[model samples]
Target: MPRSRSWLPLLALLLLPLLSAIATAADDTRPNILFLFTDDQAPWALNASGYDQAHTPVLDSLVKEGVYLTNAFTVTPVCSPSRASLMTSQYGSELGITDWLHPQREPEAGLKPGTLTWAKVLQDAGYRTGLVGKWHLGLTDAMHPTKFGYDYFMGFRGGGNSPKNPTLEKNGETKKFEGLTPDILTNHALEFLNVDSDKPFCLSVHYRAPHAAWLPVADEDWAPFKDLDPMIPNPDYPKLNVDRVKKMTREYLASVASVDRNVGRILNLLKEKNLDDNTIVIFSSDHGYNMGHNGIWHKGNGHWVLTENPPFTKNIPKGQRPNMYDNSIRVPTMIRWPGVVQAGSTIDKTVSNLDWFPTLLEMAGAELPADAKIHGNSFVPLLKGDDAKWDNDFYAEYSTKHQSHTHMRMIRTSEWKLIRDFLNEGRDELYHLTEDPAEANNLIASNSPEVQSVIKQLDAKILANMQAINDPVLKEAKAKSSN
Candidate 1:
């Protein structure tokens, strides 16, 4: 009888191709990404964050189904810079985008061509990337989303848009739409999701709601808070007029309600399509906002005038001095990746928009360019419930030639925060959050040894961060001050 033919070699060759096919299928099963970004939203704006009056049922449910970050912040408090940091995963000072782009003045200031964004990385890795919302990073043809990494771009290019009868850009063509801007944007997002594609997708849906110019929302959304009297923050500053505060609160809450309802629409769509299990959904804001907190009506310049008469004066001198209060810099952030991130969990450690780039890239299993200079470490380990290696401190900076707010840097720990005005404006602030969570008391002028010690520690940290990022303001300001 002939020796038993060894089938091992033939079987090995046949199984190799089958194994390769299985690997390809596994790669194709990578999770889809849905990033939901909001404008000027604070951490406390949602009912999930303990705001009893906020009608944000959708967000509240999301909080229950995801990891809520109580200590999330933007690298800068302004719109363009904060959004830039999110896109680049670097500080605004490093990118030279320190203020909101003024079309006439800073027309040339934006993300330049060849800048590697997380979206570009994922796109290059075979994911179908789309951005359907505000693209405040830039407006020039070369700076458009298509030039960056987006296969589909449909939204406003500027910082904001009118809620009603707004005009939008569809891959560079301006189109007019009639309806609330959030709802309209959601419809466009759903349209993008419905596209015929077999590859994994990344969609960024940024909503321009609850930002500013708070107007009456749809009658249904406005009805819940119409007669409600929300509790407004009362810092040690002069007391605000109660009636005026209530009116602003009502309108703001109404706008938030509209945003929440629209968020529900997106969530429902994901469930209906059975994509909830493999889709990673993230919600956050560019930065925080203040309605009547700390005697401030809005963000940045924290000042408002209270009339002593029945009919309040409309022409209150707007305060031009910007502030670094938590209400302005700390934003609400959450992420939901089914079976990955623990449901109903909360992370108290400090995290910023700067970490988004590395985190997303890690989730996509893509490699960063060897020469890429990224300042943010991936927080994916924290999402997987490993906090032992997390950083508990955060640093931020804001610089502007805009006369209203100028060069400033801040360093914050869990219990203390120190802000220094690099221009020697003598408008510095320090707060011990453990004792004063409202930031009502400023300790910059304190002579207490404990306060001084904390300041010394934080000052060194701020300088280290500035040096690491090659902060131009710090370098220039030090030179000017020394000279």
Candidate 2:
């Protein structure tokens, strides 16, 4: 027995390699997700991501290495509500955040406090989560991203970080932590990726680039850094839009180009860590903006209006109007997941922000609560090269503070689009998108029987989502029209 003590040590050494082999197997089985989001970015900017406008060799490499979702949209235009809706897989009103209610309004008082969220669901499914960059969902301490299930938070809580924005970069890095704010966010994101933890992670890196203060050079707009500037204002832009004097279309483009460079930064990080295959990179915006596209500077909703900015703000006549337009509602979205998602794949089908929360779950094989109601259908099927039928439509409503009086609703199908202004005695219009991507014609009053039939189908589709918003807005609006 005394001689056997030497043999016991030999057996312990033999079992250590077996344990190490099991750990390696586990690492190979789990996938990681990197959510690359930018503020006020457009789908067109991605060409720089790798399609070649600015030679975003890294972003292009990601696209070449992964899949990109071609058509994607957000639930609302304003900041907080859009993010809230994106997290919960529901529209603003359904989630009880019917306005840009964070910095400006603060979330509604008596409502469901903690419905399931994207971060919460992923954490529950065992993912290590980190939220860096713009975290404007809720300014309240209780609503911080950490409360929503993120393990680490390195972003500003208020809306944005433009030098013009007061709350920009108070804490993340400056003496507290100083540097270019967007660059700070990107650098932190790289640090998060560099983390070599065993738990799978989700880095919600929301870059504040291309949103505003459209500065190109990192240090210029803030002083001691002017060479970082990239864009100038478009002087004759309004003549191009026909409504208001243009402000800064050229500057807007420059802002976008700057964001593209940051996008390349994120893509490059993924590769540097050798995590490209397991990470899912997505790019989109809160909603559309105006860079003289429709004779406006920025937007919160006004169609058919004579000016871009607010009336008193920019001196426009009372009751100047806006018709529901594509530039505002239709935006670009890209998704890239190597091997799992098709490379350079563009479904061109209409989808909404409500779908993002669930799609992430599907990617990680996580479970959604059976009782939870998710308005967005998973495009995971689309990304996987499966032709599973999707609703192929979107219903968007933004009767919020900026255009609250408008009470607008929109429904778009594969080939047709309809818009109804509920407040205007239910005035309705339809357009053949194939013939008019700009929605220049209102086919509602047309006597053509063929157009009426198409209108009817669009109406049915609208009714389905109206039921989602609440059957009454549509029922009451439609009833008002009939009378």
Best by TM-score: 1
Off by over 4 Å in 1: 1-24, 235-237, 305-318
CA lDDT of 370 in candidate 2?
A: 89
Winner by lDDT: 1
Which pairs clash (backbone N, Cα, C closer than 3 Å) in model 1? none
Q: After superposition, how far is residue 267 of candidate 1 from its true place, in Å?
A: 1.2
Clashes of each: 0, 22
Alpha-carbon lDDT, every model: 0.84, 0.65
Q: Write the per-residue lDDT of candidate 2 for residues 1-483, one digit (tens) a residue.
A: 355477777888998898877875675567888877667665544454342333234455555655655556665766666777778887776766655553544543212447678788888877889988776766666766777888888877777565232234323342344555566777777887888877788888877766777754443222322223322223344334332222244455555555556777777777778887777777667766544444444544543323344343222234334444565654556677766776765676677888888888888778888888888887888878787878877777766454445556778776888877666553567889889775657788888898988888787877778885674566777688799
- For candidate 2, report its TM-score: 0.80
**Window of ten residues with lowest summed lDDT in model 1:** 308-317
In model 2, the number of clashes is 22
TM-scores for every predicted model? 0.92, 0.80
